[model samples]
Target: MNVSKLKKGVLLAAGLGTRLVPYSKEMPKEMLPIFEGLKGRVFLKPIIQKIYEQLYDAGVREFCFIVGRGKRAIEDHFTPDWAFVEYLERNGKEEYSSLLREFYSKVESSYIAWVNQPVPRGTAHAVYMAKTFVGDDFFFAAAADNVFIGENVPQKLAELHEKRSTPILAVKRVNDPRKYGIIIGREIEDRIYEVEGIVEKPKTPISNLANTSLYVFPPEIFKAIEETKPSVRGEIEITDSIQILLSREIKFLAYESQADWVDTGTWETFFRAIALSLKHSGGHNIVFDVLEALREK
Candidate 1:
């Protein structure tokens, strides 16, 4: 794999999503529904597809999905059923069939591979599982439980990484740094920050720049993960591993994404993500519907 190119990627979707509750019990939070419009009709696409589409659009040709035991739905959804297409055509629902065809084309254009995490480790461990797949490629890794709304997020990140020639993390200024991994750094360029320190959920807001869990890492990251010690939660954290890299004076750049990321860690944000995703899907009334539903409650 070319160091300058990002042709491979990984999606960490193995989390139990305890906060997403009863609904996530049977399904992965990454499988949560979002309103998408294709060929002039609104479609309910899982959050994973939303993530995949963005990466695919950014020129990723291969993907490795880190999933747990109950994520069979994800596999089934990606598998194209030619018989079903014939059935839809026989029933005169050719438009929906075309939608399926369009979806099949995307799957054909890219390679999809899955690795069972089997257990819920930390996010770093989840990413580590894809090391063999990543091999020597500098690849993009994203937390699949998020919906990112932006005009050209991945493209922009790729451009930044190409210019910097090192690991680049997507970061943003947030009011609550306590709930996130804060990047302690000084702005080297306009929106790029040279990472000096990273503390996971600090007591005080030293820096409002929070790690969005979107990274472009080189193959050397596996070595960093191998040297990292587990946290108090008994899980290997990517932040800690990156911190080790920083402590060694290795350069890590943070790119402030001009995107609104909606994580499924909470119900409110999930709904907001569905609404906000409409702007990318051409147009929709899901945002208004979400507002009305919340108003009634």
Candidate 2:
């Protein structure tokens, strides 16, 4: 068995976020805060930061972030602030500072590159922007707005890739397949499928396995993206690109993840993500208490 290890990651954060409205008007959706806890204290961290840290924990040392207009905040947040850490330490807040310190150490030890996507061409285009950075390496291509709260899905995907040595797509069973890209595949094993076809937001659903925007892609993905034409929405969809690869006999595997897949794209999902994160952080009781107190007010 040929074992492969992944050390490169590409994060796509270049969406217009028209659905998020005012919250995303000035802030990138990827920069939206998610609840986190350490040492019995709750902390708010950006979703993209969480994604990066999770991937880092999975042994990915090189990162390429694709950003669009007004997405400079994502880049800025990734830049460590020593003065803030020092100020926290000065105020006897070692816990908060320690978090920053650890995060900064990870950033300092890793290679992070930013690529500008001037136009909102689509997901495939955003991924294509990292072609030069990734360069023939099997890397994790993830959407910054989405994350798996309780499990390190990237590490699991890497492990599966190591065993199979094929392109992998993270999928989840959804009740409403019309809102997501659906996958049609032959089940090879438990929670594993040989992906035969994938379609974006199909009118007539074929499968409930929705694409989760987490992928372990090979270098051929870039070529597939190049050959992919625009979708009905006039944007290059990553599903279409994968379908192109499928046509050429590029085998892909669909891994149906059981982890809590949180997508902070729309208002409903964003609120749900916050709730899930709070629950994961063991802070839901505190939130419930506050809500009850507010109810008395």
Q: For each predicted model, how many residue pairs clash, with residues at least 3 apart or on different chains?
A: 0, 0
- The alpha-carbon lDDT assigned to residue 185 of candidate 1 equals 88
Give the top-scoring candidate (lDDT): 2
Give the alpha carbon lDDT tens digit for every residue of 1-297 in model 2: 223489999999999888998878778999989999887878999999999998898889999999988998988888999999999999999998999999999999999999999888999999999999999888999999998898888888888988889999999998999999999999999999999999999999999999999999989999999999998799999999999999999999989888889778998998999999999998989878998999999
Per-model TM values vs. the true structure: 0.90, 0.97
What is the Cα-based TM-score of model 2? 0.97
Model 1 regions more than 4 Å off: 1-4, 38-41, 279-297
Report the C-alpha displacement of residue 17, candidate 1, in angstroms.
Answer: 1.3
Using TM-score as the measure, the top candidate is 2
Where model 2 places Cα greater than 4 Å from the true spot, the runs are 1-4
